[model samples]
Structures are given as structure tokens and as C-alpha cells.
Target: MLWVEKYRPKKLEDVVISKKLLDDILKWAREWDSHRKPLLLAGPPGTGKTSLALALASSLGWGTVELNASDQRSWPVISRIVGEGVFNETLSDEGEFLSSLEGKRKVIILDEVDNLHKKEDAGGEGALLKIIRKKPLQPMILIANDLFALSRDLRNHCKVVNFRRVDYRSIVKVLQRICKLEGIRAEKDALVLIAKNSAGDLRAAINDLQAAAEGKKKLTVEDVATTIRTQQTDIFKVIQKVFKSFDPEVYSMAMLLDETPDNIIWWVSENLPLEYEGDDLLKASLV
Candidate 1:
């Protein structure tokens, strides 16, 4: 099995996220009301948005009703979900019936909401807007890779929470734990390199470690370097996309670079003049 799936965080506390952020999510879930806006968890991919959503549901002893990109983009499904209760699993995390006490409380996770493109999902945006504008029937957490990609009206209707990219240090800590669990004798520097290569993507770092250390009890920096060099992509293309692509795609493209997230800013600064000029140049530089 892939290490990413094997080591996935199953509880909110286990998730490597800020305590205040976790508290905010817990507070919303505990105080759920019909008038409360759904939580919009927005950030770059692989930042534990979906994992945190699932973990939150698990920690609260509530069942989860998750809608993926396909189901979420369908108007018929979205309409039905808001209009009626579709989930049949009403058991709590402890295997006890929860409906009697919590009144059928369950979290509704709408994943990849920012991917709701026009024409492809003609009525999805309108239907979602209507659902948010009206009284929210349940606790909902919407996950999006790019917050700005979503419509302004949708953003206005929900409580938008921004998640920053997971720092490499935090990622390295998780990687170290994984190495210990797997009984792999990995050099700390190799793990650090893997973490930096991932550019704040914990999942990617885990995958890299797994690939580099597979079928071996001892791992070295040379082993990881060889694998990374083979898998490395052209940084030029990433730079091009970063400057030329849409705002929503900029972060996604930047993640493709082999450089660390902190170093990406330097690359952007160096290439800013090559892409934009005059007021646009000054504005982008400020950002």
C-alpha cells in the first residue's frame, strides 16, 4: 500500500495543523445551527484540508457524508443533499447510535469546490449559492485548493478559512516518525532533503522516502539524491506557469518546483520583471 494512505491522520489532534485552526473548526461543529455558514477550508493541495475534515468528523463522533469533485459538481446531487438527508450511516465513532442524542448530526464535506468550472458544471455554482444563502441544515466543510477560484458570491456566503502550506520542519518531523515506525535507518539529512523537495507537501515527502528506502534497511543521501534527480522536472516550465497562469493555478504550479516553499518567493521575485511591467510589476512585487 502507498505510505500516504497507510499513515493518514485519523484524528483532528493527530493532524499536523495549528491548535487555533483546529479549535475554530471544532467550535463551528459544536455550535452548528441552521443560520451558521459552512466552513470553507481553502489552501494548496496536499495541505491536509480533506484529512482535517475527515478527522474533525471522527473526533466529534459524527458520521460523514463526503462529496467528491464529480458528485459535488452535479446539480441534482447538490440539490438533493441540501433538500433532504441522504446519509444512512448514523453510528458514532464509538459504534453507538448518535441520532437519538445529537439529532442525526453529521458533517457534510464538499471536496474540491474550487474546481467547479462553468459549462462543465453549469448549474452547480448556482445551486451551491442557493444552499449557502439559505439556512444551513447541517455542519458542512468545503475544501478548495484555490480560494480565489471560487465565485465571490460563494466566498461571501461561507466562512472562508485559509490554510498555509505545511512548513518543511513540521513535515520533517512527520517523516522522522514514519522512518522510525518503518524501522528504516535513514540519515536525517536525506530526510531533510526529501522534505525540501516536497515543497510543503507531506504526502509527497512520504512517497519520496518510501521510494528511496524501499527494500532497504539503511538509507543514505546518495540514494535519495539519485531518485530525486531522475524524477526532477524542468524548473523553467514551473516558472513559466507561475508567471503566466491564472491566479488559482499559480500556487499549484509553484508546488511543481523542486525548491522549498520559502525559496519559491525568491524565484518569483527574480522572474517578476520578465513577466509584468509598470503598475502590474509593482503590485505583484508587493504581493
Candidate 2:
């Protein structure tokens, strides 16, 4: 099995997230009926939001029915699956009534909810709103990298929680624990190198650690450096070129970017207000 899965946190207590945040999430899950609104967890990839949600379900001892981009996410599919799972609380997925499972609700986890397809998967967002407005029996957790991409109504209806990148130290500690468990003597400096290059992505760090430690009794910085990643132009440089460049042919600078246009738009939009203000901010927003 992949180390990422092997070492995944099985309970909320095992997750390396903030204690206060974990407590709040636990509280929300325990009081879902009164809370009403779904939990909107927005964060960058590999920051453990999905793992935390799954662990939360396990901690609450509630079964889960998850949907992601890989699944057929059309409105009909979502409605059918979610409806069957939540509409009747007395039965299990196997259609057996659990008399002892009173007040227990299945966890509905929708990954990348902000990226719902409006064209091919029409009515997805609308269906979600309808489901929430009706106050379904199950607790829902919506995951996304871009919070603003969600409709204002959807955002208004969720208890939004923003997850920042995990610090390198926290990442290194997790890596150290894995190395100790696998019986591979990984150098502290080597782990540090991997964690730093991971850019606060814990999943990436673990994958790097696994690849670097493969077929080796001891892991070194050189081993990790070779397997990790190559140096690239800083994202800040790309943003600066777009906002501060005097060059008339500014499109040329954008062409030099390694980021896909899909990501570039968000980067520019997210950073525009930070770099521009007053008339400048208004002008940038227009474009």
C-alpha cells in the first residue's frame, strides 16, 4: 500500500490540524441538525481537508457517502445517491433497518463543490441549494480550493473554514514518524529538505519521502533532492509582471508563465486587490 494511505489519520485526534479547529468541526458534526448549514472547507490541495473530513466521520462513527469530480456528478446522480442515503435514516446502504442507530446520520462529502460543471452537469449547484434549503437529515461537508468560485448563496449557507498550508515543521514531524515506523533511518536535514520543497503540501512531502526512501536503509538529502522537484520561476514574479510591468506587450510576460491559464486567472484575481487600490483597484477589476 502507498505510505500516504497507510499513514493516513484514522481519527480526528490523529490529524495534525489545529486543536481549536478540530473541536469546532467535531462540534458541528455532533450538532448537525441544529447547525443546518453544511461545512465549507476551502484549502489548497494536499493540505488534509479531505482526510480530516473522513476522520471526522470515523470519529463520529457515522458512515460516509462521498462524491468527487471522478464520479458522475450530474444533478440526477447526486439527487438519487444523496436522496437514498439521507431520506430514510433508519436503514443502512444494504437496506437493513438499524434500530440501535437512532439519530445517526451518514456523512455526505462533496469534493471540489466549487468546480461543479455548469454545462454538462447542469443543475448541480441548484440541486445542492435545494437539498440544503430543505435541511437534509445527513450532515454535508463541501470541499474546494477556491471559495469565491462557489455561488454567494451557497457560501452564505455554509459554515466556511479556511485551511492554510501546513507549516514545514509540522510536515517534517509527520515524515519523521513515518520514517520511524518504516524502520528507515531518515536524516533530519533530509526530511527538512523534503518538507521545505513541498511548499507546505503534506501529501507531496510524504510521497517524496516514500520515493526517496525506497530500496534504501537510510535516506539522505541528495536522495530526496533528486526525486523531489526542479527549481522553477517564482509565482510572485509572474504576478508582478502582470500588475507592475510597464511593457505594452505584457501578454508576452504572461506567456512565459508555467501556470495554466485556468490557474493564472485565479492568481491574478486573488492578488489584484492586494497590489492595487482606489482608482487602480477599480481599473484592474474592470479588466
**Best TM-score among the predictions, by candidate number:** 2
Candidate 1 — which pairs collide?
none
- Give the range where candidate 2 is weakest over 10 consecutive residues by summed lDDT: 94-103
CA lDDT of every candidate: 0.75, 0.77
lDDT tens digits, residue span 122-150, model 1 = 35666676666665556778898778988
What's the lDDT for residue 53 in model 1?
88
lDDT of 2 by residue, 221-262 (tens): 888877754323455676787798777666766776544444
Native-to-model Cα distance after best TM-score fit, residue 44 in candidate 1, in Å: 0.8
Could you give me the TM-score of model 1 versus the true structure?
0.74
CA deviation > 4 Å runs, candidate 2: 69-75, 84-86, 95-104, 118-123, 229-287
Models 1 onward score TM values of 0.74, 0.75
